[model samples]
Target: MPFLISPVLTPGALARTPQPTLPTGDGLLLRPWRAEDAPAVHAAFQDRLIHQWHVRSCDSVEEAAGWIAQWQQAWKDESQVQWAVVDEETDELLGRVALRQILLGDGVAEVAYWTVARSRGRGVAFRATTTLTHWAFEEIGFHRLELFHATANEASCRVAAKAGFTLEGTKRSALLHPDGWHDMHFHARVHGD
Candidate 1:
């Protein structure tokens, strides 16, 4: 049985290639996660906002290492791809950006990211997200990318707008946070946009 349309991106398209490191032109690079970066990951999670938005925290370096391992496996499985945003010069961890919930046949995925406490307010998230969005559309052939965040997350709204994702709408109590269900703002960008 043949389908009317082929997958926009083949299964091996990502797994066959080593994930490339992307430079943000603002002193940061998005690279693959490394075991040695576990400590930094653990530290970043300790920030209340990061933990609250992400809904999980690394209790120790070991747990962070486990997360790194999962990220690697996700790449191999072609289910998701993540990058550690780091300083270009010192190679210090600054944040993270990822394309998650990918649907290859549909040519879509969700964008997610967070900046470390010190990296906040400096446009790190916007730059990293824009870089990943470009790679997703130009390099991987994805047609649509979606970004959703709590309506209360003003910072994320700014980043989404800065990265050129158009506001779609808001979902009523779409996601559950530690405190309770929160309305979510839906934003998206397509291949041309």
Candidate 2:
């Protein structure tokens, strides 16, 4: 069966090309995850905040490697894409930014990110997310992008706003964290916005 309206973006759009490395003005580069990143990823998971917000931890380097493998596969599947945000000069992992829950037909995805403890308060997440947002809208032709964060996460709320996402509304108990369900603040940016 076919619908009257055509798909917003054709399938295989992402799978057709390799993910590109994006650079930010703040001396950061968002690149594909590498095998060597497993140790950094595992170490990052040990951060209490990361573990609490993401609701998962890499117990060992092997498990972190598996996570990286899954992220790589997601790009080929056209279901999601993730980038390891690293220092431009040193190539040290600073954070991560991703567009997950991608819907090709709808031309939409959810933005997610996290920063290492040292990278916090330095605008790493904001810069990386802004770069990814531009790529998603201009390069890939996404119609809209959505971002959600636990309402209690004031820092994340700031990042969303800094990245040009408008606060839309709140979803009650939309996400489950280690402590309990969290009310999520919904933010979005459309093609023109």
Candidate 3:
């Protein structure tokens, strides 16, 4: 059965990442999402900034539950890793961070995230993102991790920079936004970076 190409080229060939609480100093912890988090997640997505970039929404708690369910399945499929960014002291859900579009074969993946309005202006996204990048490159065996955001998303650009991602360039109309198709900037971090 070992005939064709290098085993490393096939994505997700390594064992799935075990769910663990990834901690960042100052009481932040990134852990797997829980069923009880549906309401909070729903509320977070209600922010215009979130739906504007994510191109997805949840109208009801039921739908939010489904969203959580879908991410859970993505993990089982080894196609994604999602975590709820929480404040360990108060146990409040601050945001979410995930590595999606995972190509284990190519040793690469894409990072995505959204934070609640309350979490905005904080370093939540940057810290959580940096933590995830390290895990992807060191633990998940990915050589590169890329982050794409709408050209108009200045906050994300800053986060990418602060997280050690260098701007690679723009992808013309690479993603569709609510107003119409929009250009995207691709920021990346290699293994040694």
Candidate 4:
């Protein structure tokens, strides 16, 4: 029995999946990231807060372009899904939201988001998160979606609550920040929740 083994990845294991355009609310939409959006993404990540929490910083346009490319490859790898939150009227970038760490076999995902500096306090993150939450639960058929944030990130915590993601608990020193490790608060929305 100890000698017997099974394959973890079989033939046709990973497939390229279609990306979707989702409408959050009030003329806001979540669309697939485009190469053209790299400039805006670069500008948005310039904020200190974004770097404080998001670790990965798109310091330049080239890095931003690479970021988008990596996300595209992630989609093909069936590992993550991402979107650029935009204003439907002006087509201006508001923020970015993503369901990463996707475990398809277990039907689990982690939602994360950030607003452009100019879009902060406008509920851009909240609306996008709320809309994405529903989509992940119903349309995408995921059993559970979770959102985790540093305990010090009050804004993100508020957004998660407003999006109907219940706070599960805190993981002590689970995230390593630039300054030090952080205790991350966990929030989740399960199917039928």
- TM-score, per-candidate, Cα-based: 0.97, 0.98, 0.92, 0.90
Backbone-clash count (model 4): 0
Worst 10 residues of 1 by lDDT: 49-58
What lDDT does model 3 reach?
Answer: 0.86
Instruction: Report the lDDT of model 1 for residue 106.
Output: 89
- Ranking 2 against 3 by lDDT, winner: 2
lDDT of 4 by residue, 1-193 (tens): 5535444333223343478889976889999899999999999888899989977777799999998999878877778888999999888999999989987767788999999998999999999988888887777677889999999999999999998899999999998888899999999998898
**What ranges in model 2 sit over 4 Å off?**
none
Instruction: Please give the lDDT score at residue 6 for candidate 1.
Output: 80
Per-residue lDDT of 74-135 in model 1, one digit per residue for the tens? 99998999999999999999999999999888899999999999999989999999999999
- Report lDDT (Cα) of residue 174, candidate 4: 97
Query: What is the number of residue pairs that collide in model 3?
Result: 4
**57, model 1: CA deviation in Å?**
1.9
- Candidate 3 lDDT over 1-193, as tens digits, reads 5758664545445334456678886678999888999999989989998988878877999998988898878777878879999998987999999988888777888999889999899899998998888777776678888899998999999999999999999999998877899899999999997
Residue 140, model 2, lDDT: 91
Best by lDDT: 2
Ranking by lDDT: 2, 1, 4, 3
Tell me the lDDT of model 1 at 151: 91
